[model samples]
Every structure is written in C-alpha cells, then in structure tokens.
Target: MGLIGDYRRLMRAGIALARHDVILPGAYQTRLPLPARIAGRVLRIFGGGARGRPGERLARALEKLGPAYIKLGQFLATRPDVFGAEVTQDLGRLKDKLPPFSMKAARAALAEEFGEADAARLFAELSDPVAAASIAQVHKMSLPEGERAVKILRPGIEHKLMVELSAMKRAARTIEGISAESQRLKPVAFTETIAAAMMRETDLRLEAGGADEMHEISHKSGHFVIPSVDWDRTGRRVLTIDWIDGISLTDPKALDRPGIDRKKLANDITQGFLTHAIEYGVFHADMHEGNLIITPEGKVALVDFGIIGRIGMVERRFLAEILWGFLKRDYLRVAEVHFEAGYVPASQSVGEFAQALRSIGEPVHGKPAEEVSMGRVLLQLFDYTHTFGMSLRPELVLLQKTMVQVEGVARAIDPSHNIWVASEPVVGSWIRRSFGPEGAAKLVAGNVKEITNRLKRLPEVMDRFEASLEPPAPPPPPPRRFAPWWGWFGFVAILVALGIWAAK
Candidate 1:
C-alpha cells in the first residue's frame, strides 16, 4: 500500500486514539468546532471506559499502536509546550520495551548477516536476549577475546517503521493544513525529523560509529563510561560491543552500593551532558535511565548510541550563553541570545521578551532544588514561543529533549539535584573561555585569516567578474534555416480554414 495504505493506517490510528478518548479530549470538547465536538462524543462512546488523564490515555493508545507510535510518543514528549507538561510527562513514560524475538529468529538474523558457518563460529556461546526494545534486542555472547553484547534489529521493523512514518507524515500534513497555529510548530518538519531519526536507528552501522565516537569523548571527559565497539562482529543489522557489567539506573538498587555518591553522580549526569554538548559538540541524545548504568567501579556508564545529538559551533555558543545568562539572572542577555540566534522573529520586542524571560526566571530564583521544576520552567519558556512569534527549531529539538531527560534522570538519582547549580561550573567555564578577551582575539584572528584567504583569491574573483561583464553573443539568425514550402502552405491553409469557419 502506498498513499492508500497510509490513509488506512492513519484511519486505524485515529480510531485507536478515539477509542482512548485522546482525539479531541473531553476536557477540550466544548472549545472544539461543532463537527469535531460531535465526532469526539461519538468516538468516546467506543472508549470502553478508557480512563486516566488525556496524556495517559494517549500514551496507552500509542503504545498499543506499536513501535513507531511509541517512538512518536517519545518524540512528542519533548514538546511540553505544545502538549503541556503533564501530558508530555505521561508520554515520557512510554517505554520502548517489547517482547523478545525468538532465539531461532535471532540466529537466523545473525546467519543472514554473517554466513551460517561464520555465525555459528562467532556466536557459539550466544545467550538469550537480555533486553528487547521496539527496534532491536540485545544478546550476550562470548567471543574469543571477551564477552560481547550483540544487538540485532527486529526482522521486519524497517518496513514497519517506513509505513507508519509515512502515515504520520500524512497526519502531520493534515494537521498543519487544518490549523494555522500548527504551522508555526512545523509539524511536517517535526515529523520528518522523527522519521529521519527512526530510519537512522535501523542501521546498526551508524550506531557503531556513534558509540565509538562517544567512547572517545567519554575517555576524555572521564565523567562517563562508554563500551568499546567490536567492529569485527558488527554488521548492518548487528552491532557487537564489549559487554558492560553494571546495574541499570532503572534498577532501584543501582544507587544503593556502598561507595556510590548520589550527589556527585547527579552532578556528573548534568555536567557530563553539558560538557559533551558544549565542549565536544556531540552527546548521546538518549540519556534515559534505561540507557545508563552504574558500573561496579562506581562510575556512570552510557549505552545505546542509536540517537546522538550534534551541534555546530554557533549552536554551542547559543547554548552556553543562554545557560550562563539564566544562571546570572540576566534575562535581558537571555532574550538577546534568543534574538541573536534568530529563534524569535525580529519583529518581536527584545525588552518585552526579556520581561517574559524574567517571569520564567524570577519565580524559581531562590527556590530550593526540589521545589523548582526545570521541566516546568522550560515549558513556560516554550509557551512564550507563540507569544513572541517563535517557531520550532528542528536543529535544537534533540538538545532540548535530552536536556529534559538529563534533568529528570539527575533528579531521580538525587532528589535535591539542582541543574542550575550543577550547570553553572560547566557553563561558566565555557563562557569565560569563549567570551573573555582571549576569545575576542581568536575571533579577530579568524576574521583576518578569512580576509587573507579572500585576498589571495582576488585575481580569480576579478577575472570571473570581468568575464560576466561581457554581453552574450546574439543567436546566429536561427541557424539560417527556412521552413519547408509545404509547412508554410499548411500554416496558411490552416489560417484560411479558421477564417472561413469564423465567417460561416
């Protein structure tokens, strides 16, 4: 099925959501259009006692829809401004877990990747799958060198994702077409971003490269542990990496170890993410508790490289300045950064934007770590996006999403975790290095070097400019070709026939 198939899938999805009372939720029914209100009432009849907050109902509906919807829910969880904090929080709880595929199926996949004989030789001691997610599952295997974790993509997940993503794109387009406000959110672009990320996740090769890069970054930062990739055993559908022995952060007992320092661990989570994003410009975008583990050595180990966030130097500066400005309670500077970054429209008043920022910041100024919710603050800030003519920045989606995840994980590790306090040291250090006198000198040097390079190419540039100044030669009299006698006679005859018909 192509377009028709997408419509069918969307219809099914709509029905499922309706049954869960997710589409035009009851609370907002009165405010909706007459037709929509009637539709919601009719759909709610099929709800079958679907109970909970609208977010909860939607999460369950999406989970029931399958992996692609679950991923969509997770992506939507990042936009607390559009969905609201409670709804997004509920969406955030949408797990990627799925029942593990059969061992026979797993072996078949391995054999397909590496010929049967090679698969047998390599995974002779392959154990049962230890964990399974929507896209893939992991198995522990013993290699000649050491123990390795083998990740295998689900058999038909790629095609499944393709179909669902197509339907989602259609839905996003439909939503945008129907609502003027939704255009600012760029639902189509947002869906495409999700689609691209999901497609990338299907290819284990990309994950392997990301894992290796993060491993190197981890080594430098010494704030997190990243397992080494086993390149020899890796393939498009399979990834083999060193098996990590640790308790997952999701385990309640992960932080119960005698030597574990909760406060330090919490700070490390926050600082480590900032350091990678600001300094290295790359980070593990998926930092949920399940992807993190507490090693026996009392270190935090990061896993799952399927989603990595990268930012260029400009975004790095934007992030650092924004964080630093917030830490300093300089709402004006924060607003300036937003304007400089072009996140807000030029038509918006900078002073008024600063006042809005002050509103978000002032309330949390002296509040205790536990009392303040960064997630709420972020929600409010994003809510102002519409007020200030701000649109969604696709490039910063992952960064924003990961920030919320990091904050949540940190708070879980230590309830009193203060992201602002934890971020100050890292953010401040970066600001000092980047905005200080030394930074100015480097900036000027870079500009002068660029100018020097241009000067060297001046003769080449002048030659092109001079060449463009010359007028084009005229067409050579239509190749001096004449139409055949019959052609002209036929044209004259056609004109005469038309004139005769008109007279008649």
Candidate 2:
C-alpha cells in the first residue's frame, strides 16, 4: 500500500512534467516511445502556454512536483556527467522558491526545537517568512542591536523526502534491470548519494556547524565574510545568525553598485573558493550566485551552509595541480595527474591522453575568464571517458559542480577576469608550498610518527601472542588394564634372556 501510494504520486508528478513539456520536448522528443510521443503531442495541444527554455521548463516541472522533487533536481544538477550539460544546467537553474507554511506551523517548529521558555527568551518578535525554500523558511527576528535571520525547517519534510526517495530507488532498480548499459551509470548509487545529501540538510545543527567552521576558515583569508551564529538562540530545527545586508551576486545592478570593487570581488570569490577547498579541505558545495552576497563594505559573504564539501590532501593536490597545469598550458602534466589519481586507467597511453586533454584545454587557456566556456570544458572532459574508459569520480562531483558555479559567479562580476591569474595567487602558492622541500619533510615526519607509535605497542602485542601459545594442562593418564602388567612381565623376561646371551 505504501509503495502503491508513492507510485501514484510519482505518476501524477510525471503527468505534470509532461503537460509542461519538460519530459518530451525539443531534442529529447525524438527519444520518446510511440505512446509517450502521442500523449506528449496531445498534452502540448491542450497546454496553451508556450514552452520555455529547457532549463526553465525543468525548473517549473520540479517546482510543481513538491519540495523533495525540487531538491532532487538540485542534487541532479551537480551530476553533469550523468545528465548532459544542458539538462544539468537547467536543473541548476531550478530555484528552491516555495510558498511559506503557516505562521502557526513555524511557531510550532521553533517551540519544538527550543523549549517553550527558551524559545520565548531567544526570540523577541517573529515576523512573517521573508524567504522560503523547499526545505526551510527564513524569518526576521528582533535583537538588541540588529536583526537575526532565524531559519526553521518545514514541518514533516523528512517523511515527504523519504517517500520521494523510495520512488526514486524503485525507478533506479527498474532502470538497472531493464538496461545493461545503465549499470555503468550506477543509477542506484546515484539515487543513494542524493538521498544522503538531502537527509544531511534536514539537520540544522550540522548546517550551523558548517557555517561556524566556514566562518573560522574565511576569517583567515581576509577576502571572505561569514555571519556569526547565535548559539544561545539556535536549536535543532532553527538556526539563528546575524543578519547581513548585501547585494546578491546574481543581481545585474551589482555591476553598477557604487563603491563596490567588482574586479576584487571576482578575484576574491574564485581564489577564496579554491583556497577553502585545497588549503582547508572544506567548502560550500551549493555556491550559486544566490548564496553569495557582496557586502556594502565590499566583502564577499557566504551564506546557506546546509550543503558543504570536503576533500582529502591527495584530492586537493590533484585538483590544484590539474588546474595549474591547464592554466600553464601543460596538457601532459594534466594528463599525468589524471593517471596518477587513477581517474584514467593505466592501459590508456599517457601521451594520447595528454593529446586529448590538449583539445580540452587549448580553447580555454589564456582566454578571458568570462569568455572561456566552462560548460564546454566540462563537457569535453566528460567526452574523454568514452575514448579512454575513465569513469567519473563521485567524490569530486560536488567540487567540480562548485568550481563551475564559482567561475560563473566571478565572471558575472568581472568580464575580463583571468581565471589563471585569479587562481595563481592562492593555488600556485599552495602547490609550491605543499609540494616543495618543506612539504616533503612534513610528510616524512607524519609517517615516522605513525611508525613510532606502532612500534611502542609491539611489546603489548608480543605479550598477548605468547600468552595465547601457553598450552593447557595435559589430560590425566589412561587407566592401565590387567593384561598390560602381564605383557610388561613377559617383555622384562625376554630382555633379561637377551642380555645374558650377549654377556656369554
């Protein structure tokens, strides 16, 4: 019954998508089955409104489906390799804008997160929601000196998302069963990845912690801004932070903002994102222009900490070197990095792979940042998988997505922004510092410390081994039979006779 209900809901959502010409339209129309093609035509005839751009149509269809579906679209946007660039870009454009729930529901959620007494003390005045998304809503709260942005999760979001996810899982299973080719795509694993990310966002504490950590990291760079979290006022469902008033990076008017340094803003955003990812190993994964703001004082402020990404030292080094190689027009090094990182199989020729990379890098190298087609670069890189049998690394998906979005934001602010130059100050210095002699010494010291610790525990391990080797008590001797004594006497007599004969 539960599955039936979910399937019904999914069908309704599909109909809505078809009616909106999201599923069967433009280039994708050719791939549809005959039945779907006929239905799609009929729906288009009845649907009076002109179809929008592919991305816009997808956004609308996702919006109509519900909050969880909206989130699914956003999650899919990060996977350009699985979905083509056009569809993923459209998914990326899908806004999380949804109508706010009732004020009473908001109050109830806040009260649940914080005890009634604490809730009253923390919040002085709770205004209507100023902004709402698929998962949560934001409201202005009165404070002593300034206002606070209080974010509260929508009621029953977890249950809704779980149901939607189950449907997705079923669909993934069906696809895997139907098509052998789809197995390489790992549809089930992709669905699971989206589910985990969505589930994590439901927890406000983790989100708050991400913001606090980002703030600490950003403070060091002196090029970024992060608002303070009010721990006293924050709760599991509600997160409270100091309000920030700044121009959104998406705003066209930001270009003309008086006293705002657009070029510096562009450099800071690009460099700051890379530094955070490479140097600190943590970054905001969902960094669209909407999540970015330019302060009145010209600082680049980062907000909406729900989705963050982390990478290990090895991945960071690979990313930095790869970007650096492309920037330097060293396609061979770029290809080498991919092979070293096991992105491309060893069977593939390094020289041939380098030549393939050159095709991808040459167009964008040394070009103005705004003019370089990042989408094309990503698409071309994706195309290499067919030639070299390379698969996309799941761990780097968020990083790649964020990098693309960051470049778009930066270029929007400054047209002639040189990605290489903007990135060199942070990425170049990091490479030289991390891969140099001092870096080698640090790496060796870390390994030595680990070995020394293991050696110190060897004595204890030896003692345990010796204790295990100690044998248990021997079993009592078997009782002798009466015949054994007679046999022994005969043997003694025979021995005496033999000894006497030898003596003679």
Candidate 3:
C-alpha cells in the first residue's frame, strides 16, 4: 500500500482502539519511551482515550482494524509464550463474530469461485449465514445429496485483508527499527506468518484440504471425528462439510440433558487432541469451546483448521519424553529433553536447569494426580526456554495456546478434570509404542531399511557429488591495463615468493 493508505489504516486502527476502549495500556506504557509518551499524550488529545482495561482496549482496537488484525489478535491470544497469560486472556475475548454481508454478496462470491451462477444449484440449500467471523462465516446448508454446513469467505475479505496486512508489515518494520529487543521476537517474521495464514484462509480451498487430511487421520479414532468435506460444493470461496449436531462443550447443562458423560467428554477432547499431536503429528491449533462440539453419542468433533500445528518426529519425541519425564517426577530427564532438542542453551548447565525444573515439578508431584496443572507445568517449561534464549517455535506457541483453551473448555465441563491424570494413559501408550522393545525393533528395522535404500542409490549419489566437485570455468579475462615497470616487478616478486612458500 502507498504511504497515504498506510496512514489511513493506522489512523483507522488508532480510532477504532479509542472507540472500543480496548488498549493494552500497561504494555504500551512500558514499551513507549518518554518521548513517545509525551507524543502519545498530545496525540490522545486528538485521538481520544479508551474506557476499559488496557488489554480489552487492545483487543477491540485490533478487531476494529479489520479481519486480518482480528485474526492476528486471536492468534496472539493463544501464545502466552509471546504476550503472557493476562494479556492473552484479554485478547481471547476478541471474538470472530461480525455482522453478515448481504446474500447478494455471498451469492456473487460463490458464483465467482465456482465459475457459474448455477453453482448454488449444487447445494440442496444455502441459507443465510448462521455465524460470521473475521475471515469466513458459517451457514446452515445442505449438500447436493445430504445435510451439510457451508463456510463462505466473507465478501471482499481478500482486498480488505491485503490493505490491512500491508499496513501491519509497515508497522512491524517501524517497530523493529525502534525496539532493539523486538528483534528476538522477529516482528517482521510475525507479520509474514500473519500474512501467510490470512492468505491461506482467504481461500476456502485450503481449509477444505486441511479438513480432508484431518478427517482421514481421525476417521477410525473413537475419541474424535473430523467432518468430511463435501468436495462437490467446496471451492476457493466456500467449503461444504457434514454439519455436526452436538452441544458445545461449554454448555454443561445441555451435555447433561443429553446424558453426555462429562468426564468421558473431557477425556475424549484431551485424548483426541493428544492422538492428533502424537499419532498424526498434525493437529488443529484452535480447540476453543466454540470450535469443538460433543455429539449426543459422545464423540468429539473439531472444526476451524485455519490455524494448525505440526511437529516433526524429533520434536514430538522431545515433547513426549518431556511430558513422560514430568509425569514420573524425573526432572533431570525433562531438562535433558530441553538440551537434546537444542531448546536450552548449552552454556546453561543442565544441572541448574534440572534444578529449576524440579522447583516447578516437585510441588506438583506431591499433589494428587487429579490436581496437577499440566498447562502450568508446560508454561514453566516455556518460561525456562525463554530465559535461556530458545527461539520460540510458532507451532509450539499455537499448541500451548490451544492447550490452555482446551483446559478452560475441559474445566468448564468438569472443574476437577485432571488433564495430566487423564493424559497419562495416552502418553504412556505413545511412550511404549515409541520406546518399547517392539518399538526399538521397528526403529532398527526402519534404519536398516533406509541404509539399504541409500546403498542402492550410492552410485547415483556419488555421481552427483562428483559432478558438483568439478572445477568452475574461469571468469572472462579482465581488460588489459597499462602498468609501470615497477608495478610489474612487484607483482612478479610477490608471485615468486608465493610459489616459494608453496614449495616450502
């Protein structure tokens, strides 16, 4: 965007924050220098003051900025690793709920995405939007042959997102230049992540793809179910999936009315996510109460794949071992996982780190299994990582945020829900599957198989390496220049000395 556009957006954001009384007063106070404070005070004379808590004001301001900023704020709420607990909780209130655009606009978006006006004919019904959020909205609709839910991208969300996103990038750049400490957080990289996620979200097609993959993984799992995508009606701007009929986990009264076992429901949600994280290595990052539903038959259904977390084998192993270590009160093992994963700086003695881990773990270990705070334990672990300069993994940040959200939902279902206690069975199974004799045998077999495959490709690998080692062609000769006799003599003398040294 141009400078004028950026100014307009910044002005819009400032105005909106003022209007909604949503400002992170404490954070802003600490962040701004004295000069900035004086300037801010003067500006506030013109900009107006917010009316509520700083955190609330901050969330409202982002929501007012537009869909992209709203989504950014939502993502930020999940990362206590970045903003801390109080601020994250405040931002969590920035609901995606927004007023719906006209049906004409929704129809036009569908027509454009599906490449035909008759595209609406594909769905048995495409009623008015039931729920509207920052990037997309949900409608109670039907597939060509059966019941389904249609998620449609908000009309012109792309253009609005681009405008807001460009402004964000500019703001991040300016902030980076101003704050030396901001470099570690990588404001620029954060902007890139926001941009990338918003771009993917703007295209409903990507959400469909994510749902499809998750569905395959969760298909036979008894604890969770991912709604199947109705590909016939899915496109760039719209996705159709089987409509889930269940009560929100937050609604305990309703769950009870339907005879849904609260404890079982809690387990299903926790263990379900665990299955995704450990077994599939792909998991939904947003598991807030609104996104998760409990079917009458007691199955947990998950939606909203806009933000997902992925872990590699190494990270998953580290996470598993860390959790297992904590479960067994093996603080040393937990510290070792941090070192092995390169999360803790080598300069920080492992013994010291282990002692710190014990500080957090020992108190919890004495408590009954049902009373432990797994999320708090994880938070302490992350705090240690931050203290030691571990580069925060964005995926882990999302995972932690979702874990907190899941805890809230679970606690709402059953205040005494012991996540660590519930998780032990699942974590134990994963550990055995990963480290038991059978698991070790499988590991060895896989390694040997890989070696055999590499040996088969040894000739091809050597050919490529040999080809790469070939000397480069010399550069074109430089234009000849006239030189004095003294220069020539000096060059020749230097060359002679270099040759003599080489021989020596």
Candidate 4:
C-alpha cells in the first residue's frame, strides 16, 4: 500500500485505541524515555482517562479497527501469560462471535464458488448463519445426503486482509530497523508469519485440505471424531461438511446429556491432539471449545481446520522425549532434548539449562491440568531461551499454542482434568511405537530401505556431483556502463542490498 494509506491506518488504530481507553498504564509505559513518557501521557489523556477495564477497551479498539486487527487480538488471547488474564478473556469473546455481514454477500460468494443453478440444486436449503467469524460465516444447509454446514468467505476478504497486513508489515519493518533488541525478537519475521497464515486462510481450499488430513490421522487413532468434508460440493471460496450433531464442549449443561461422559470426552480431546501430533505428525492447531463438540455417542468431534500444526519426524521425537521427561520429572532429559533438537545453543551448559527447566517444571509435575498453568511455564521457557541466546523454534510455537488451547478446553470440560494423567496412555503408546524393540526394528528396516533406494540412484547422484565439480564456463566480457536493462540487473541488486543495510 501507499505511504498515505499506511499512515491513515496507523492514525485510525491509534484513534480507536485512545477513544476506547486502551492505553498501557503505570510502570510499563512510564519506564520509557522522557519523550516517550510525554507521548504516553498524551495517549492516556486521549484514552478516556482509563475509564474502563483495559482489556475490554483493547478488544473493542481492535474490533473497531476491522477484521485483521480483531484477528490479531484473537491470536493474543491465546497467550494469556503475555497479555494478562483480563485482556485475554476479553479477547476470547472475539473468537466466539462476530457481527455477520449481509445475507446477500453470502449468497454471492456461494454462487461464485458454484454456479447459481448448481449451488441451488446442491443445497436444498440455506438457513441463516448460525456462527460468524472474521474470515467466514457458516450457514446450516440441507443436502441430498443430510444436513451440512456451508462456510462462505467474507466478500472481498483477500483485499481487506492484504491492505491491513501491508500496513502491519511497514510497522514491523520500522521496528526491526530501529532497535537491535526488536530485531532479535524477530518482529519482522513474526509479522510475516501472521501475514502468511492470514493469506493462506483466505483460500478455503487449504482449510478443507487440513480437515481431510486431520480426519485421516484422527480416524486411525480411533478415539476422537472429525467432521467429514463434502468433497464434491466444496470449492476454494466455500467449504461444505457434514453437520455435526453434538453440543459445544463449552456448555456443561448442554454437554452433560444422557450417555455422555464428560471427563472421558475431556481426556479424548487432549489425548486425541497429543497422539495425532506424535503418531501422524499432523494435527489441528485450533482446538478451542467452539471448534470442539461432544457427540451423542460421547466422541469428541474436531472441526474448523483453518489452522493446523505439523511436526517433522525429528521434531516429533524431540517433543515426545521432552514431554516424557517432564512426565518423569527428569529436567536433565528435557534439557538434553532441547540441545539435541538444536533449539538451545550448543555453547550453553546443559547443567544450567536443566536447573532452569527444573524451576519451570517443578510446580506442575504433580498438579492437575486445571491447577497447572502451562502459560506460565511457556513464559519462563521464553525467558530461558532468550537468556541462553537460543533462537525461537518456529516449528514448535504452534504446537505450544495449541497445547495451551487444548488444555483450556479439557479443563473446561472437566474442571479436574489432569493433562499429564490423561496424556499418559497416548504418550506411552507413542513411546512404544517409536522407541520399543519393535519400533527400533521397524526404524532400521526403513533406514535400510532408504539406503537401497539411494544405492539405486547412486550413478545419477554421482553424475550430478561430478558435473557440479567441473569448472564454470568462462565469464563473458564485461558490459558497457550504459548497457541493456538485463545487464544492469546485478548492479541494481547490489544497490538494493546496500539500501536495505543502510535502512537497518
């Protein structure tokens, strides 16, 4: 976007925050330099003199800023340790509900996904949306097979998200350039991560793919349930899935139906995600109560696969061993896992790190899920990572976030739900499948098979290596100073790099 556009957006965000009374007060903002302190005072004065709860004000301000800001707020809600309880709780409200756009817009998106006649023929009835979220609104529909849930992307959502994210990118760049500490925190990379996710979410097909993959893995586990996507009737801008007949796990009275086992369901949801992540390496990342349902059969049905987390074989093993260490109260082993995963720098002493891990893990070893706060643990972990000069493990952050969310859901389902106790069975099974004698034999066999394949390709591999070892072709004569556009490309690239360095 143009500079004018970004300036306008920044101004609007500032104005909204101020009008809604969302300034950070006390030592936090006052600790800055004199100029910053004065700016803080001005903001506080404009922020309605702290007339309301800061968290609620913040949430309202984000809502006023539009869908992208609301999304940022919802993401922050997942990090209670970072944002504090009041703001997190208020932000939680954003995830459960959002004002619906026009019905006409929904129909237009539906017709665009499928031809008007075809869509009309496929969905016998398109009831009003039962739930609305930032990116999409879901309508209850009837198909020949049965009742289905149809999710339609908001109109012009791609453009809106892109515009907002562009402004955020500029701010992230400015921060990264101004402060080495901010650069170390990876503000730009972090913003890029969020922007990438929002972009991927604009395309409904990716979410459908995630649902299919999750169902495949979760089905193999045979405990949790996932809604079946209606493949034939789904499209890039729309998703149609079997309507789940279950109560929201968030509502205890509605969830506590005859034949339902609340505690078991809680265990299933927690174990389901844990086992799926380890066993298949792919699992749903978004598991808040609204995305979870307890069917009449007492099975946990997973839905809303817009976000998912994946762990590679190495990372999966690393996670399993880390959790196993904590389960056993072995801080040394957890520290070893971090080093082996190359998360902690090799230069750091394992002994000191283990001591630190002990401090973080000691409080939770014997506690139930509801009593233990992994958010607190995560915060401490972040502190240790920074102190040790360790780079943040991007691959595991999603898993960490999902773990917090899953724990919250489990606790809500049964206040006394013990995550460590509930996860023992699944973790034990994974350990056996990954490290037992049979698992070792299987691993060796797989390695041998891979070696055999590589041997078959040995000739081709050598050919490429030998070809690369050959000297490069003689360089062409240098172009004139006023050469063709293509000839100046290298010089232009160097200038761009120089500009970036100077900006930094």
Highest lDDT: give the candidate number.
1
State the C-alpha lDDT per candidate.
Answer: 0.84, 0.79, 0.75, 0.75
**Residue-level lDDT tens digits of model 4 in 115-219:** 898877776588998888788899998766788999988888899998899999877776555444455557788788788888898888889898888777766
Residue 104 accuracy (lDDT) in model 4: 82
Ten residues in sequence with the least summed lDDT for candidate 4: 494-503
lDDT at position 163, candidate 1: 91
Distance from true position, residue 169, model 3, in Å?
Answer: 0.6
Using TM-score as the measure, which candidate wins?
1
lDDT of 3 by residue, 1-504 (tens): 898898667656655653443322333756654544443443444334455666676786786666888888887786777777767877876767789887888878778877665675774378988888877888887644567888888877888888888888977876565556678889998899878877988878888889888888887555577888988888888898998888875566787675668887787788888878887788888787788887767788888777778887667878899888988989898989988888787888899888998999887875764567666776676677667776667676777777777777787787778777777888899999999998788779988998999999999999999998999799899844324444335433433333233223
Expressed as tens digits, the lDDT of each residue in 131-238 for candidate 1 is: 998999999988677889999999999999999999999778766655565677789998998899889888899999999999999899877999999888899999
The pairs that clash in candidate 1 are none
Residue 211 local lDDT, model 3: 89
**Pairs with steric clashes in candidate 3:** 21-57, 22-56, 22-57, 22-58, 23-54, 23-57, 23-58
Model 2 Cα lDDT, one tens digit per residue, 61-177: 888888878888888888887776777877887878888999989888877888778777777598899999989999998777788899999999988888888888876765565
Worst 10 residues of 2 by lDDT: 494-503
TM-scores, in order shown? 0.86, 0.84, 0.84, 0.84
Better of 2 and 3 by lDDT: 2
The better-scoring model by lDDT among 1 and 2 is 1
